[model samples]
Target: MSTHRPLRIVFAGTPEFAADHLAALLNSDHEVVAVYTQPDRKAGRGKKLQPSAVKQLALEHAIAVEQPEKLNTALAQQQLAEYRPDVMVVVAYGLLLPEPILTTPKYGCINVHGSLLPRWRGAAPIQRSIWAGDEASGVAVMQMEKGLDTGPVLHVERCAIDAQETSASLYKKLAQLGPRALVTTLDDIESYRERAEVQNHDAATYAKKLSKDEGKIDWSDATQLERNVRAFNPWPFAWFELPGGKPGQRTVKVHQASVSQTDHRSAPGTIIDCSPAGITVACSQGALTLHSLQLPGKKPLPVSDLLNGYATTFAIGVNLTNVD
Candidate 1:
């Protein structure tokens, strides 16, 4: 290890991704003076109030934890100021930092963004990158500013976007890559700050937050639909409706799929073939072979296994409606 003195760090984040970064900080030589996460929210089957992953980890380590609804209040800012941090690290913290909180620490604030700067600069970057067919995705350690994710880059860690990479898989990959990068940046933050590169505002593209309505499968482009299936897995999953069934009864979630180049004259959403391998459905440009799927209130299963019980539902020649 270098001879640089360890700095006092104040970490603010929520969710599992944030927790991973906090874990790294806890292992480092730096002193984590305090932790700030969102207030506990109701979750799960019982809808009970639950602590965030970061909060839970902080409590386990006996670190001081703060759960302010918003940081704009005087009490919140005063509490954060009491930490006397050298630098504040922010991940997926959910709540926006006011100007006072931004300048509270000696080093100001730095964020661990989920995408390469000047490309994807907002929420849902991971999912949007896969959906937009980006060849690579990575994390950027930057000096936080008033503008949303438009910060000077201190360091970056990149990784290839595999052909079959899903948001869940890519998320895990970045989660691992990000902590190491964060720790590396903290190792010599002053040097990194002096050499920080400004982002190009011209090439910036916004990654808007995802919604359940966005998950409705559009059969117009099989290639894009395939990407959508991968991007939306485990949340607002890509779904389509059976032709004859009623509104709520017809929705089917696609868990796994691949592009099929087979020639097909059937209309978009038509079932071209149903076999043990998969269910090939026609699209406007090409066909998509759905491997795993889930019906309403049912567990996801491979098409071959689903065929054993619902053969008629996915039978050949049946039209799968694209419910918008």
Candidate 2:
């Protein structure tokens, strides 16, 4: 692609979130000189080596793709110098950029972070936002520095967090919004108004990458909503233990849930009522209506499906609690 003043851009990203911005850049008027992505790693049950979404897109676009083990190496630095890019656009690149790589691009690097800066500043911003019940969250395009997501904001596009929004859904929204903000900011490069706010480290909290164990739903300790059954949907699914029978008693995973403030109360995790409407369970503060669930080795099915032939022999007022 030729232009009046072509920009030599180095693109760095890994996942689908980054891929969205990359697609925008490729279709833009600028020249993308090189693409940087994380090394291919084993994925799926077979553990076959799989390239990232960004890497796959780069291949289709016929752009030179680099999968370096680390960027700090002398070899990596030399390869980057060859491109001589004017600006580096980074989105969830996975690996941290040291001073050498950050300063290589003439205009420094710009990052597309999922959350509004000064809050949810670390990994897993999208998931954490829903868990915390934040009213709003969005994407931040920042001037990249050595500090972790502590760069000066170049532009931002805010979006409201719906009551029933999940990490998967919110991620798609932010991914698209990010590129729009990037394009707008680049359009008025000289006259763009930058809003750089210092993050309050005291008020800041980290959302560590989730583990499989985090999916286990502790009905006894968690409020109906705080358990966040929907937030954990499709990933680490919220699970609860069922009564033991013989060896290897099965457990149930609550795939979907509904929230309500009911005066009816019992021990947490106790099944208060079950009907065609839903399976109502007592919670720490209020009652939770379980709409969908899954048994071990079975697909997720609606509460009505489970009730048809696999009727739960849940007794009223039975205090049910799951222990590790």
Candidate 3:
């Protein structure tokens, strides 16, 4: 039993990360009056319409789910006002709220952002942090304003970035950390709001959304390539063109890699060594050891396992071309 006063929270989010926060609010002493999520999107091989993770969870709990195409319309704003929410919590909602909706709530809107304020303040923070070699990553609960993530932060939970941390792993870490922080802030909302700290706008850096084209591997610097391999894992995986193959058959996705210790004088992208351990490729600054890879239409496999059948394809002296 909590001693704090219960707040009528209107939850707005769309992805798995947002669903986690909604789950926390549901378990707490707060009353979730309504839920808002993105419209169903077509996905997978069948192209069938798929409900977002947040919507599915909201339905399972019997919460009223709202899926408006855009909140800028008058009817959408009226629907939100009917909830009479004490506060609105937004987490990766994917739609911008206009000023009227923001002011409708008694306590206004607060967002549970994926990164610390004044850094990585945009769509793809987790991926961008790992891609940029950031030492730490965390979550921030801030007051939402018209500007993009420029609001004053009420509470923050920080965590260190491990040497081998991938975007997928970091995303899970923050997903767990964020909900606890949100609940804690809501426990004493008035005090947290009064004590919110304004962010330093000059220090902020935007984390632009990712695209499939950004996954192409250049085989230049071994360290950067290794970081990219980790950052883009599980989606648009880091890839390169295979040497001596037709156009459609040349793309090979790299799943796992590490900086190599072996000395090599061969040109960049040249396969210097291949064994059951891994496939070693030479780069300008250093060498990289590819532990796992995926061929066209094939599942990702360790280099040792791939050697059983595609040994000639990845043979030593073959150059992995950097061309698209």
Candidate 4:
């Protein structure tokens, strides 16, 4: 049992990352007085309404849920003020807290950010870290302030980035790491506040939200292409284009890949070998072994599986390019 009195916390988050932290708070000594999440969104092929991960979890726990479109509104401000929260715990909450909301809580608002502060400090830290080929990435608990993620750090927990780690996988790791850091910081909030240090703004690099165009592979640099394979998985996944007979291009999504040691002078994107080993495409610097891939409107399959059926598409001498 905890010796300290429970802190009154107002939790704000939207995605699974944020929801996981909320879950941690629910299991901890702190009392999450209320939960705030983004409004329901239309998702999937059916385009049906779906509540955010945080909203779903908050409903399950019977916590009072708030889904104001914007917190800056007078009504929204009044609604939160009623909670009289001691502190606000924010994770991947999409909306920025206004000055009113930020100042409402006694201790202000604190965030469970995805990266070690003063590094990748924007909307998409997990993907950016892996895209930059960072050896390690971690979570940071910080006293939230105005600038992007430019808050003073309270606590940080680093984790090694595996050789083949993807955004989907690394995100899960950080999601689990973030809550523990928040819990420890909340355990003794004052000490962390006093110990926090201002971030070096000069060293800060923003990790902008990814786009589908960024997933196009540039095979000139094996290293960069390899990083793209891992960094973009599960969203804007690394992709290439194959000419479809007479006209149009067949889009293929790379599911899993690795840097190959095959020494080749062929032009980038040239299919030099395709066998049970994998589909080896000669790049400008080296080669890429595509183990798994997804043809448009088809399920992900290993190269061996494709060889048995789509052999013509993976045939040697074929060039996969983004151009028509």
Best of the candidates, TM-score: 1
lDDT by residue (138-192, candidate 2, tens digit) is: 9988888888888777788999988778778888889889999876665554444
lDDT of each: 0.93, 0.79, 0.92, 0.89
Poorly placed runs, candidate 2 (over 4 Å): 1-6, 193-203, 220-227, 245-251, 313-324
- Give candidate 3's whole-model lDDT: 0.92
Write one digit per residue (lDDT tens) for candidate 4, span 168-267: 9999899889889999889988888888988989999899999998998877787788899899999999998776543433778998988899888788
List, residue by residue over 1-324, the lDDT tens digit for candidate 1.
343579999999999999999999999999999999999999999999999999999999999999999999999999988899999999999999999999999999999999998789999999999999999999999999899999899999999999999999999999999999999999889889988999999999999999999999878899999999999987888998776666798789999999999998999888998899999999998999999999988999998899999999888888777443
The predicted structure with the larger TM-score, 2 or 3, is 3
Ranking by TM-score: 1, 3, 4, 2
Lowest lDDT 10-residue stretch of candidate 1 = 315-324
On the 0 to 100 scale, the lDDT of residue 130 in model 3 is 91
Query: How many clashes would you count in candidate 3?
Result: 0
Enumerate residue pairs that collide in model 1.
none
What tens-digit string does per-residue lDDT give for candidate 3 at 1-324?
Answer: 333699999999999999999999999999998999999999999999999999999999999999999999999999898999999999999999999988999999999998988799999899889999999999999999999999999999999989999889999999999999999999999989888999999999999998988998877899998999999987788998886667988788999999998898999989999999999999998999999999988999999999999999889998887344
Regions more than 4 Å wrong, model 1: 1-3, 322-324
In model 3, residue pairs whose N, Cα or C atoms come closer than 3 Å (at least 3 residues apart or on different chains), thus clashing, are none
lDDT of 4 at 215: 94
TM-score of 2: 0.90
